[model samples]
Target: MAPLIVNEIISPDTNLLIAFLIGIGFGFVLEGSGFSSSRKLAGMFYGYDTTVLKVFFTAAITAMVGMLFFSLFGWIDLDFVYINPTYITSAIVGGVVMGVGFIMGGFCPGTAFCAISIGKLDALAFIGGLTLGIVFFTEGYPLFEEMYKANYLGTPTMNELLDIPRGVFALGLILMAFAMFWVGEWAEKKFPREEY
Candidate 1:
């Protein structure tokens, strides 16, 4: 009858090894989930298929609920978990850029890597573009540094920022996801297309 100690259980090297193993599993799942196919991924935007939405939302909810449950039961110390700081302006700008990239490239970072590993030519091109983009960013970091650091909103969770309980936000997200799923289901029927 002992509680689970999930934080920093091993040395950094061991943690990295675990990360590698987890990454392998993640890559396997992505490939198996048809994320390696640009056409399938692109179908999300065109309303042809919503596998991406389903998978992404399912994963998010699962992680959210699991974390909540774990913290409730004191199995994991929630304080040790890293939450991203809310940089409102930069977050919005970066997300918009990434959204455009997703639509244009048909591959986010993880999926692009998985596709590249599977010998996808388009994914390879995307990777090249990503590398060039990173290089450009680094080279022009000086010029963009000010804008990047302009919005200095320290790490504030939704609960902190909105003065609402975390559970309320989680519940809201779940409801919104359900609504989107309903729409996706309708769209799938309304515009059935041959799958790639």
Candidate 2:
């Protein structure tokens, strides 16, 4: 079984088939989870519905814990996994831009796509705006390229930066997620909104 598992080869056709299946599952789950509703997603910022926050944090923590467990068990190769190369300036600037866009547009890229797929006209307009924003970014890329590429710290994780073990970081994240979940539950009761 170990030999079969380690030596298993996926043909291009099989890989594409698996990719399609995974994509379909992802789309179905997103739609079912109310992610296809921009208002539901935007409600996180308004303290109306906190489902988005709960789902997102839960997913993040789950993935973090799973990856850590996989590494501990030697089931996955951590070294082969790609990590984001830190560019301090770009990270700050990009985060600020994303925050502003979220506040103004009330939809992030993935949720906007999900909403668009479900025939939300607002999401369609948001997508149009996103395209324009992308075009503008591309046209202005040269101007920002230097700053964007500056202050590079190669693939540094929070564990490496803070001198903490990955498991400890993952555990902390889980605790934080639980705290957020509790707060989200309270907020939902404290500030209830009508369901659409």
Candidate 3:
């Protein structure tokens, strides 16, 4: 199929179908992994349950390594993939705000939706707040637009910034994931709690 769907080889219907299937699988896995519970999700912050940490770290490493391998084997066209333009300071601030929100809400947007599917009232309230926040941000974009565009760093991969081989970065990431997994395990044992 000419390496990638970005080449317009796949029909729109097929592309969307593939996305729908993948989304369903992702949601199912999350729900099965106890991520649909606010208590369990919050447990990670409390060091009582580290399933969230392990699952997410594994997923990230897997995706990164898979992408690297795919690029190496000519399975996909990396150039056709969309990359977000990096605004260094704004990006750091945005990520901090996002982390704080996640800690407060006990559910990131994706898990909030998963919890809502399972009839969690807290998730419903979270969704309402998220919608309101989005509306406010859209309405007030002009006020923050300058700051949003302040740091105009072009999108560059780790290899580009660190001047290291892509494989080296990938290896370092995998090692870091493993180290964190070990810490997560220890945390779970140190603060063991019955399943929610």
Candidate 4:
């Protein structure tokens, strides 16, 4: 049975410790993959390096398939999984903001932290700006609260929303990820960038 914490098989402190260890490993992988470089990260948008796309796509597919198999094998309880509630308006706005920030800063939050660990000054600035953005958002929460809560789409899984079986949805996503990887490889060749 998975979700040991939810099932009360593991204490909350142990769960948190596990999460911290996983986070360290994940950060190490990110840094090893050259995610600490702002130019490399920004290359995703420039069509010069598609490694970012491939890495993230592969991760998504892996997680999706892993969870599907886990559920099928009764190793994990799907009902114990948490799905974040969808706030359509806030989601759209947040995506746009994050996209813009990614382009300008050349690092998402996770990657920024990775860069900071490697002593990147640019990443330090990015973190400062990110902190300011967070402060601004929190201070202005009351003003944005209405817009944030506008679209109240209750938590719904993709398969449930599309009225398809989980296996079918996972299959479709895996196929799509393959196609995207093909395109990404082609783009990298078409828009080649110097080694970082």
Q: What is the TM-score of each candidate against the true structure?
A: 0.90, 0.88, 0.93, 0.97
TM-score head-to-head 1 vs 2, winner: 1
Q: Please write out the lDDT profile of model 1 over residues 127-156, one tens digit for every residue.
A: 998899899989999988777777888877
**What shift in Å separates residue 194 of candidate 3 from its native position after superposition?**
3.2
Q: Which parts of model 2 are misplaced by more than 4 Å?
A: 1-13
lDDT of each: 0.85, 0.82, 0.87, 0.93
lDDT per residue for candidate 3 within 1-196, as digits (tens), equals 2335676778777887888999999999999999988888889999998889999988988988888888888877777767789898778878887788788889999999999999999999988988998898899999988888898979888777899998999899889988998999899999999866
Highest TM-score: give the candidate number. 4
Model 1 regions more than 4 Å off: 1-8
| lDDT (10s digit) by residue, model 2, range 79-186 | 767787899999999999887887677788887887888788888888898899899989999999999999999998998899998888888888888899999988
TM-score of 1: 0.90
Worst 10 contiguous positions by lDDT, candidate 4: 1-10
Number of backbone clashes in candidate 2: 0
Q: Candidate 2, overall lDDT? A: 0.82
Weakest lDDT window of 10 consecutive positions for candidate 3: 1-10
Residue 99 lDDT in model 4?
98
Minimal lDDT window, size 10, model 1: 1-10
Ranking by lDDT: 4, 3, 1, 2
